[model samples]
Target: MDNHPTTFPPAEEDPAYLVFLDSLDYLPSDDVARIKAAYAYAAKAHAHQKRMSGEPYITHPLAVAGAIVEWQMDADAVCAALLHDVMEDAGACKHELAEKFGKPVAELVDGLSKLDKMEFASYQEAQAENFRKMLMAMARDLRVVLIKLADRHHNVQTMSAMRPDKRRRIAYETLEIYAPIALRLGLNKLYRELQDISFRLIYPHRAEVLAKALRAARGNRKELLTRILENIRGKLEHAGLRAEVFGREKSLYSIFRKMQEKRLSFSQVLDIYGFRVVVENVPTCYLALGALHALYKPVPGKFKDYVAIPKANGYQSLHTTLIGPYGTPVEVQIRTREMHNVAQEGVAAHWLYKDGNESSAELQIKTHKWLQSLLEMQTSDSAEFFENVKIDLFPDEVYVFTPKGKIMAMPRGATVVDFAYAVHTDVGNHCSSARINHELAPLRTELRNGDLVEIITAQNAQPNPVWLSYVKTGRARSKIRHHLRTMQNEESARLGERMLRQELLSLGVVPISIPAAAWDSLVKASGQKSLDEVYTDIGLGKRLPSVVARRLLAREDMAGDAGSNMTLAIHGTEGMAIQLAHCCQPIPGDPIIGSIKKGSGLVIHTHDCPVIRKSRSTDPQKWIDVEWEPEEGKLFDIRIRVEVKNTRGVLAQVAAAIAEAGSNIEHVAMDADPERLMTSLRFTIQVAHRTHLAAVMRGLRHIPEVARIHRERGGEA
Candidate 1:
């Protein structure tokens, strides 16, 4: 039914596999024996299973392991890759693998197992948890991730066997997570291939169109490639430099993204063909760059020297784009043989360490420090591990020069604060300012690759809360929030304790009698911690004073008429000289009454005070009618208002006179005025009694700038 060639043998066929093994230079040895053992075990375990494509189940694992072998990985990784799916798919157990092989191999196999038995409420939750566990496994050992990537690569490559909708979902996840990780680890070739495969699956129709267009244009670009290669090779030869020039065509995914993002047609995409110039040394890399520029006009901002400033993933290459034959844009890359090995193999080069003879220990460690960071940040649960993994391994990077001209690569949009944190946590904690390109800017300022950043720190300063909004690295953000949250919790607990202790003391209760056992239970019942926690809750508005008092009273066996307890005595006459509750303003001339509320003690109010009217019907026993006694020199703070001409010194003069008249100003506000050049000011003041209030009002009346002054009479219900 398909139009493509039917003769293309399936990957699992003996002929195809022979070619794969030959390409890897696989030979008969102990390692080969171990691989054979794993293959036999996997073949038996998956004997009854069949793929959606009607292939035997062992074919999938073989394909996955085949991808690993393409990277020329170690024998253990290849064996682990072959058996990775056995535990998850079949009834195979870890003990069997351990007995057959060793614990390390068994552990590797177990780490790759997916959570298949548990039922999740939603596919999203299951996916998240599964990904989380996979990342944790990768943190424990990088080989797990390498094998997983290989598995994903093979699955994507053979996605035609899957339903269209399933293919799209898997493709999206690959683009969002897998491809970025590949690039983050400096596996550029693998990264591009995975992206292209996913793209073909997710958008088959569009992919076909692009493919056809690329095919049609291939002939047009052929001569351009030959000419450019010839020109570059000729120059290197003339310069007495040993160089190998090869044409590098852009992948389908790269072409598709460029066309879409730049809104260009296939023919408009001129930078599709590039050349990679492999040299013998770093000095020759620069020399080749000069030769290429002299042959063609170099694009101003298209040149990047990653060799001098290697990427975070240890990618070292000199890159540049120039106007080539017939005005076509062509990209050129230059690197040494060592750089090429690191570029192609990435962390897989670490396997040379196990081979027992590595030339540079420091270089190997330097190349893998980022991998170690991923392992370090992997300290969280599976879900968090993947979340942090995606962040820490993001491939999009910005290269910046240090104050000493040393280059450092960080995530794109990484700010000065991120740089500071990257330098050291202590430096980040105390960072106060930064100068990018020698110009003072905010600490959250995004840093450019070549920009020289000067970090300014102070011992007394700590990270600002605002930095969370701009920091790009997960480590910096996590550390900043962790520090701030800890500080806030401690401060809040301290304040809460102080407030609780004060309220308890007012009751003539020495809280010392409360046993630790009883206190812990009471605190839990109150939804808090120690006494300080109770107070902190009070200060934070989580708990009210009256609520705690009521709960404490119930626990203390003190139900003495609620309000008429010894701590708070109601009127002796049961009616005269009632005290007004300052919570709501109540003037002396206003009709007032008293109420006995639980825990809050005696709460007096104006006769028509809204509080009494609202609670009057709920509990009559608690509301006791009382009368205010005249001539009781009880000072009450009340809010009043005064108007004066808008002037700068008017506030100072008013405050001075109030102080001079023996009245305390509790609160004040000046409202804006446009006409009459007058401003209205509200003042809450404390006076000895109504007579003192009148005296205070009379003193304010003599000020010539005062237009009017009046007490805000109590409200009527």
Candidate 2:
């Protein structure tokens, strides 16, 4: 063997960058010039700053801004992208930025800045609050959200430099918050990329395992993917259709998610890769799909024509999974160029809405409507803003149709009541009848897609408290609760005033009229907004009337002699007495009697309690005189046991019976021996009083398969 001198290859030179001027190939002259100037300003501002990975920090911001440009973002978003981190890392204030760029740009930068001065006990709490702040800011301006997403996308791309734990936390946050918002905004491409990148970091072992499997499987599909692409191109050409066909593999994260969701293992999973066909028009999308089905057996129920029914996020494509020549499942997606752009960039494509330049107006219109709802939902208290936004961010939506073909998206498991409220508060409060697909349906019926819903209204049909259990949408749930609470307060105040008057008469003390000034002072001292609020608090059990009376008496004594002990005790029932009841679980209703049990000051019991039954026969001296008084509605707990054969729908059947009987269940616990095929269920229900309790028990007893039903008091039959 001839041994020659070993030669080493010279190191490869770094890849040359396309100049900014060259990269502005398609951008308008004026727009390109503006961006070039912004680039220079940002470069100088970030000259000394460096990233954790040792790259100039300007590289990161520029990368983010470049992504924005790819999305065809407007001038404002571009500027915001360039300066997203200046305030956070450079110790610059919003005012300085405003002086340099403009108020809008500075505000966007401020919105992206975190409250770094404040210390958090845990990273989780800081992360949560930071996320809340981001969402709140996004609600105010659409550009803030777009730029933030861009920043997040680039950060994820370079996440390997961070510690594993930090990477995991960041990935989890991106998946939970950023990805969902992007999906909600119709940015499917960004959403998928974020999710896939996050998934890889969070589960590296699984990612590697899947990657290995994909490599092994690729050989089997390489020839197939190529043959399928060629066949599709030939067919499209034969049909006088111009199209571009490319092979597409399912992302590792996506395959992992599908397996997790469907409870399948690696081998059980199919449709590992597919092809995407981009055509010139909408009609061609359909025609290409037909050509595909002719070549392969289309999988039933795996076909979706989103072009006709685009998702709320504005994604439109023809998706079909087909069984190929060897019975392998292959997914194919068809879309036109415009649809493809929207599919990838989502609302970001709105940058092309104007003449030769779609401004971000279309995106602003869609996202702004949602953001406005967030603002409109602001409670009087700022403490509830973050809580409310959290509720709104949970976007498991169900798409329902109106009678006129309009699509409305509401939360999943939403009832007709939720639908009514989603339309308008007036519609919800006055809703009397609902027809889904032109047939009368119960208001609590769960809505499904493609169901044409029509609401029938009565002028006086105010929302009933019963609807709260069935309504799933937060808007409807909140509105109904608010209305009911208002009504309850008004009635409680009126009743409280009457009770106070009676007490004054029984005490042999004439009601003292408060001077206007004194009454106002009393109201203020009681921490009530109005006299009505004071009385309502007393009636609603939030305050004690006797306590208020004692305060008033002390004030009166300071002013003048109000009464003597004899006068104050004119009646035999001297001291203030209030007690909870046992039988019928009397709460604000039913005849109540005060009984002085030994050691217990005053034990109130419902007139029908078994204890009262025995007390009347023995030791009547312990019972004090008492009667029903006007009060507000309150919660009462009563238990019932149902013995039934454990059939397929026995639990559901009994629950439906009780619900129809109008008794609300506070809680339910059930026990059963599966082998014995029998079950005993205990339910703590809320009822108005004795009459309602009896009616509810009778209804449960009537349920089929209910072998027995009995009322119990603290486990006593």
Off by over 4 Å in 2: 1-51, 54-59, 88-91, 115-133, 161-163, 352-364, 380-399, 410-412, 459-470, 481-512, 516-543, 547-590, 593-626, 629-717
Clashing pairs in 2: 351-358, 352-358, 353-358, 354-358
lDDT of each residue in 1-717, candidate 1, tens digit only: 111212332345566556655645554476666666777677777878998889888788888888788777777788788789888888788887787766777888888888889897777667767776776677677788889888888888877888899999999999988888777666777889899999988888899988888787788667767877888889889888899899887788988888899998777775556889899888989988888888889989998888766776777899998887767788888988767766776666555323432322333465466555655554334455556566776647888877898777788999999999888888899999998888898887888767898889998898777898888887787678767655655554554454345456656666786557766766889765466667555544455444465467554454333432222222222211123575556655555554644323345676665545767776544554444445444556788889988877888888888887889999998786767499988999987655677888888888878889887644510
Instruction: Tell me the RMSD of model 2 versus the true structure.
Output: 11.1
Least lDDT summed over 10 consecutive residues: which range in candidate 1? 568-577
Write down the TM-score for model 2: 0.72
lDDT string for model 2 (1-717, tens) is 111112321112312113434555667776655555555566666778788789877778778877777766666667678778878887778886776566877788888888777787766667656765776788887778888898999998897889999999889888877888888787877888998899998998988989899898887767877877787788788878889889876777878987999998876674445789999888888888888888778989898877787655666789999887667777899987777777777777776444442223444566777776665655543334445555556666668888888888777788898899888888998999899999999889999867889999899788788897777655776778777777666655764565445445544546676356766776889887888887776556555444455455444442223321221111112122233544545544455655544322345666667756866667554444455443335435677889999888888988888888887888898889768778989888876666677778888878779999876652253
TM-score of each: 0.72, 0.72
